[model samples]
Target: MFTSPFQDYVIDAAQRTVLFWDVMRARGNQYVEHTAQDAPHVLSYDFEPVMAGTDLPSPVNYGLVRIEPPKGVKVDEAKRPFVIIDPRAGHGPGIGGFKADSEIGVAMNAGHPCYFVGFLPDPVPGQTIEDIMKAEVAFIEKVAELHPDASGKPTIVGNCQAGWAAMMLASYRPDLCGPIIVAGSPLSYWAGVHGKNPMRYTGGLLGGTWLTALTGDLGAGKFDGAWLVSNFEGMNPANTHWSKKYNVYKNVDTESERFLGFEKWWSGHILLNAEEMQWIVDNLFVGNRLPTAEVETTDGVRLDFRNIRSPIICFCSHGDDITPPQQALGWILDLYADVQDIRACGQTIVYAVHPSVGHLGIFVSGGVAKKEHREFASNIDLIDCLPPGLYEAVLTEKTEDTPDADLVATDYIARFETRTLEDIRALGTNSEEDERRFATAARVSDVNKGLYQTFAQPWVKTLITEEQADLMMKIHPARLEYTMFSDKNPVMGVVKSMAKIVRSNRKPVERDNPFLVAQEQMSDMIIRSLDNYRDMRDNAIEALFLSIYANPLLQATVGLSADEKPPRARPGRSPEHIELVKRKVEDLKARISHGGVREACIRAMIYIGQPDSAADERRFEFIRSLRKGVPGELEAFKLTVREQFFMLLIDESAAIAALPDLLKGHADEIEQGIAFVRQVASTGGEPSDAVKERLSEIEKVFNTALCTKR
Candidate 1:
């Protein structure tokens, strides 16, 4: 207390210096270790390759690998297998299962066989995106062959970039896919709102994908993924420059392992072939063609999202700036005219929107994996049972005292609430003006890309060399940051040596230490400043993009018609489609008088239940237990019930009129069915008056049928 301020200042400064040096040494060690481990490929999962894409006729660097189940977990070969495809945007594979609490882990824990679609660091020479898609199809076929006892096709989970890839595969070969979960995947490329998403404007502002071609050419036909990683980091400067490093420094002693482990995956950049990169940019990114069915494979077959027969589940987050809820959910609006159109196409689309979670967090966060993914994995059968329509999978936390809590294995309850196209629009930033602007951008991109390809590509390709390209990649700003502070740098050798001494004689600061508190305040100030700068820069970019692309003159110059509206819906169904739907409806009507008490009861319940409401896990568990007690073939009965329920939803009055035939003379079965319906309806709370009325009406129908039998 009696000490001079200068002495106190000197002591605090010395402690800070020691801590700083130690942090630098730890970072250097991490950098060196990560580099060594990442030189080949970085995958958190321990996997053995089942098949390599190179072994196929159309070779690719991709591979199919089965994930080894964690200790105490056993795979169920009879259960539907899960194939998780991680985003290969910039970082290496395994983010989908980087930890035990991840997508793959959740599937494995649920006793399902799991596989991963990962790629080598180097792209196969002369490989295209089409080849990769083919390889993925082959991988899925192999997995299917391996699990002959599996009840259904493999469930594929696609994260971010891989989400679109999986969709392509599903669209091309619908027979091979089952239920597909596309989380944080942007199908609608140009579908972001102003002020919130600046990345969408990047392609337009940079004048289309010509720059992409140029960059790839300069890289000796290999697009360096570090550039993509840099773009991601640029989106959050505070985290990139301050928070990420400060987190490790502040908790260096305990945080080293976790931080290093994550960085190993984050820093392991991959590569893409020039042709693959250009095709993605030209067809998907700037052109926005995937949802429109304009993208064609090398074999001239078109990719149509409507062709996918598997039930599609889209998992997105409102808080994800990279793939916002609009980008994730807008394709439904674009491809189908309305919810009725979805039903007519016989597609079951389920979507879940988390209130807050980043893009990566959607796939990798432990909390998400536990709640959303666990619920999804456990209730795949329930989802499969749902009628052909749009629905939202809602998850709510289960309280300790909640009814049937002991009977449920998970902590969250899962429910599927029927949703409408309007409900989906509510999740998006649906501005007609924004749509028109993006359409114009797409047109302009076509012009700019053609001009570049015709005039500039050949010259650029001729001047680039392998050695120069490798040097350029090595010196990329993102890679340099890591290399500059590693053992490769002589200046860091002293830091490593000094850090060992500091570690042995560590003098940790207290939480209330004045100097440490002040340091934190300074760090926060820096982060705030960086955030402010980022906001300003993003706003400016947005303003500049609109000023250039929204010009009427530019629209005319790009050959876009002046009075054209955005193409929001797919073209009307052809005559063949109309005839097919009519025939199917006729067939369903003919079969309406076909089943017994179980079918009639399930159909009537689906008819009367409120579409706005959802059933909890307890309800699903009760159903499962009820199924076990029933006297019929379980799987076949379930399928019949689902099909009958779907027919009822399509034509309520016709389906209800035929119910008497279905339940004729089965008085005891009718009573049992009513009790089961009541149990399901009353799981969350008391049944509504509407439900009670519906139950009464169903009872009256059964009574009438019994009297007729008499």
Candidate 2:
């Protein structure tokens, strides 16, 4: 018999409440179990430890582990191994491989040996960031040693906080890394659009990281990572306080396991050394030093991102409020004057901007792994072969009508379109006045930090005992919520029994029940209210931050009034570097017409590719499949491509005219060469009129050279 709507609502509500409490009880139990296990990690795949940082000369909590491929997944040891480093910003390790479909799975599925670089919950006492860097280098070196016959150096994948870390390692030891992928990592901390990114205003509004120092001191010299986790939760108050729990409560039967699993990782907060936190705040966050090459090692070795020799791929999203596209890609503007500077330095940089994906989604989302990351892994060789310039990595979903669909190995087709500095600038950036405000904030941070260290730090350190600090961490709202709902709590025993009885007599409501619909509407209204309040609060914080920091008096006090240049000023290239660029271009100009049919064919391909300013994987794959008539390896082909590309950039007219000179002896094969170039170029689709014109020019050159030889 059908029940009344009101009776169904009462039964469903009662059952949901019991199941929700039971899930919370389960989450607490999992938290307890996870903490009890030594070296706890959330990886779904099994792995064996390779090396610990403690085994190194300078110990850290970090360790390297080799992932064992799952059933039916065969890894090719001859291929370059992949090393994935997860972010240690408040959370414990294994985010990169916590699920079957993740960064680790992508590389492993692609037949590459995979390794993970993760850290323990607690840092080795007195361990610094430099130690972690050194440990990472050692881990990569070990991987290379294990695969002596590998094709190249290990590819490094750094997610979020680890992205900047990967960049640093590549810069410090360029030869140790192959291609570098930095996903959702903020390199330029001060960059953001005015009203859209309220997080950038936080440091300034909080009086410039003084609270960070105070918290560290209160923690008895250790910085509680729960504080960082709290900050992230604070970004979306509705989700933190209401919607997250409400969704689980509403769908308790099916959503409980997933909720508990995610909470296991989320609630496992770690620790950072007070000194380490201070250095990060001083150097990267407030000082904004990494992008400008102002950071150096203890031994005075300058860490310049420009010095990295490998191809760097940046993945960011427009939907990520924490690390927006500006912060992820703005460092390019900070480092180079324009795209010419990038090419002149012999660097290949590619970036992709997702229309909508949150920061964590960039790393852990299964859909992201299947599409973006799979494409990246499959086309890594193409990325390596790309000529030194700025290119945007665009992934188009493959369809039945896609051009050259048979050539695409994956579900998506990847393309690297040539981009310019204007493209990055079009995203968004701060004005000169806005930059001045951030500069003032940085100056104020330094002053405030100094004052805390001198006056407040000593007394706080003396007053907070280790036991007292431990109690404070235990009582932290973020942690307390989990512990309070655990099995250890006497009150949860009743909840567990009640949940079991409800499950035995479960009677779920129909989808169209009036009361259920009304309940959802109420939830929507609550969320809307919370979101609006958040917006207003953020707007007020932003306005207050601008008013205080933009004050001329405060600016003058912080040594900004007399300076006409922006605070985070762009550093110009040195005379020696300029001379080096000139020498390199002159060298390429001298060798404008030097090669065989291979060089002519590559030149033709790149020449036609310029019209559309894009080249897809199909075209690149076709080029790679060409016969090795020339006595050279893949690296040789890459070098030839770069040389010919540079020749074009130096003098396009001369580079084209010299094609006949390259094919001087091979004039008999001119027709075959044209067919080859035309075939490879058409993989993307039918060529434009401009491309046809270029192809016609090449034909004329081939005919003229053939006749002259005859």
**Top candidate by lDDT:** 2
Q: Alpha-carbon error at 98 in model 2, in Å?
A: 1.8
Clashing pairs in 1: none
Q: For candidate 1, lDDT tens digit of each residue in 599-707? A: 8877876766754355455766677776654433335655675588667766788888999888876876776776777777667666678887887787788778777
The window of 10 residues in a row where model 1 has the poorest summed lDDT is 629-638
Candidate 2, superposed: residue stretches over 4 Å from native: 627-632, 667-672
Clashes counted in candidate 1 amount to 0
Q: Which numbered prediction scores highest in TM-score against the true structure?
A: 2
TM-scores for the candidates: 0.94, 0.97
List residue ranges in candidate 1 displaced over 4 A: 1-43, 567-571, 628-638, 665-668, 707-710
In the range 1-710, model 2's lDDT, one tens digit per residue, is 97899999999999999999999999988888887777888988989999989988889999999999999999998778999998989988888998888999999998899999999988899899988998999999999999887766789999999999999989889888989999999999999887888988888877787788898889898999998999899998999999999999999889998888788889888899988888788888878899999999997878888888899999999999889999999999999998888987789999999899998889989999998988888888789889998999988889999988887889999989999999999999989988989989989988898898899888999999999989998899988888889988999999999998999999999889999999999999999999999999899988988889889999999889756676777767779988998998899898888888888988888898888887689987776667433334567878888988989988999999888889988867877888898898678788899988888888788778778888
